[model samples]
Target chain A: MDTLEQDIKILIIEVLNLEDISGEDIASDMPLFGEGLGLDSIDALELGIAMKKTYGIELEAGDGRIREHFRNVLSLAALVRHQGKGSLTHTP
Target chain B: MISWDVPIVRWVQWPGIGAAELGFIEPLLRRRLSSLARGALHVANACAQGCPSATFVFASRHGELTRTVELLRSLAHDEELSPTLFSLSVLNAAAGIFSIARGDRAPATAIAAGVESFGYGLLEAHLRARKSPAKPLVYVYADAPAPDPIGPQSGDPQAVFALGLLIQGDASSRLHTAFRPGTMVGTPATLQANACLRALERGSADWTSDRHHWCWNLR
Candidate 1:
């Protein structure tokens, strides 16, 4: 679980070009958009691409909980783990 | 000859092609700017310090072609196009970013005119300024050579550079510029920044294209 959280943080930094930021800077439960990290909608879509490429997860628009799963690193880690059971789908 | 008196209030140009210090913008927003946009916004911000609201003319020969090419390559590979790159790949990306940064809603226009982008940009700025003589016009021209993917340019490679001009309605300003149709043979396209700088320093400068002659004289 800890490793998954750290991986997601690295992925965020790399994919978003978040210079001078590291996994240590991002708390697992902090919001990723409009508040804590202050990321915008474009960033959300970018992260969705990175996550899809890394974990083979496909986010569909019809899923209502997409926002919830993308709320923070903790939720993203959980989603990756849950989807790793071969349901390579996402709601992003 | 059609011309407008674009009296220069102040101007700034990049020392040369390099990183621009745009510390004024937030890191998040700043990170998104290409080097071209950074140099452009830096000089534009310098010339527009006191005047918060004005009409803007942003001209570029190859505006964000680097980003556009990358997006196209991604599409060719059947890869998901990066949303950020797709959004910022437009010709007016720099102008749009400038408006967003300043939160100034003044009308802005972006121009691209082959090798004569700088000259035509100034002409456009004059036309827009004519509509509202009371407001200052911020004219910014920025370009790097067309990226390699587009193929080599016919002329010498132009250095990555940006020039900003603050034009007011004062008629007594020493700078006088004019352009007219002319035929010139065997001259490489002149980068307007170098010509304008020479005109400012040595009292006059002239450049020619296949269709027009642009000259700046200081009186």
Candidate 2:
């Protein structure tokens, strides 16, 4: 898929330590939390941290809208791309 | 089945400053790791596994508060705390890591009971063993004394230790132990895990050298 989707999938694999999972195994439109990836609340927190480190987007505490943003690999990729353009920083 | 009276396995000691260097307790502390990166590497060698009916117990005093304090300090300074350090600061990281590594899906509990951590951990282990007469329950206790600035006066510094017990169901493998509730004995200069280990190693019915309260009878 696109660069953003690829990057998000990579982050998911790394943070969750899902040893048997690969980027190719994750469908772009498949749900991440329940049926597809089985990720839990802890994984979500880890994903939040990874998003901050990689995309420089600090998720606000009251940002309940992130639930829709993290729906699936495609949704996460689109959100990262949209946020990456405005807030992304390259720390040397 | 494993016995409690006679020593089934000798406990090995892992001495280090933080989770990365310390043995068996790494997984629980992985999410909260900060300055204690060196400690996690210490106990990187050991592993344990068993049945689903078995329960797991882990005990530690002080836990990984060193890293927790460091993270808090960094936050107060408005600095970015290291993600690795922040992840491994919890006390249960060791048990979680061990469970993940061994692929042993048994329910596990992590306990921090101050100075009585080791004794309480052992008590829990005994109870689990009693409940599951066929499966072996694993018990692990590990700790690193609080660092300087906090000062050693709070407790013993430079003391890093871990102990593992596999309690089996077979009567032949069981060790006879006597338990007395509400007994406050002297504090042992050595680590608590070591004191329990020393008693088990010698097959002694009673041990009081360390400020610990323990008695056993081996057939």
Candidate 3:
């Protein structure tokens, strides 16, 4: 997996406390919500907080496209790598 | 019916410590402790993991609220506390971590009954086991007194301790517990976890421990 994808997977496992799951088990295109990874809204909020702290990118409530952006590990990584470039303010 | 009388197959104690130190106690129990048992202990100590240890009923009087308070204090002072500690500060943090670690999908509850925290937690665990006859539930109770500036001036420093009980119902080790409400004084020494262990060791049907001075009878 690419750096971004790997990072996103780590973040999911870390934030969600997915005990038995490893990055290898999470398919790039598998849906993270509902039956796929079984993640819920609370997990999204947790991920949002982690992203803001780690990448300095804030996710606003009205960002309707968040569902699409956080669909899976691949999508989340793409979003981070793209928005992370100029929008990030916190440096590690 | 679940039995509480089974002789304790194994018991290990880790007093006044964190997850790392708590890990040290496992080796001693390894000869008799099941993989599930060890996993429960690990999960109990490391609350971030979701697999709940097969806990009967867990209790924490102060819980890790102390960490939350510390984190808030650090935030107020613009200080950066250790992220790891901050993450583990939640009240149910340890229990949650243990649950994840053990991969126990069974029902586990944590209680904060103040001076009665330990007794109440035990009662809950005992009741659950009685209701379900299959397996012994692990019950762990621990606490760390508040720190200085907000610390209890007269209370014992480093009083933290945890007790893990694998409770089952059977004739030979059949155990019974009774509670009586009352008041007392003097740092509530009987409320200490060690005191409770002593009571159990002696096969006392009635005894008291630490601050929550209420009396309990266990056979």
Give the alpha-carbon lDDT of every model.
0.82, 0.60, 0.58
Candidate 1 DockQ score? 0.71
TM-score for each prediction? 0.91, 0.55, 0.54
- Which candidate ranks first by lDDT, i.e. highest? 1
The best candidate in terms of TM-score: 1
Please give, as one word, the docking class of candidate 2. incorrect
What tens digits encode model 1's per-residue C-alpha lDDT throughout B1-219? 655567788788885455576777888988888888988999888888889788899998888898888988998999999999999988899889889888888768999888788888888988888888888889998887778678546432356688898887874565667888887866667676568768867888987877788888866
Name the regions of candidate 2 deviating beyond 4 angstroms.
Answer: A1-92, B1-53, B80-86, B153-159, B171-173, B176-189, B205-212, B216-219
Preferred candidate (DockQ higher): 1 or 3: 1
True contacts preserved, each candidate?
0.65, 0.00, 0.00
The superposed Cα distance between candidate 1 and the true structure at residue A54, in angstroms, equals 1.5
Residues B1-219, model 2: lDDT tens digits:
123442233233355234333343434334333322233223323323324444567777777777777788879888666554466678877666656655567678888876667766777777776676566566777777776456542224365556666666564534565544323444344454555555566655443333345565444
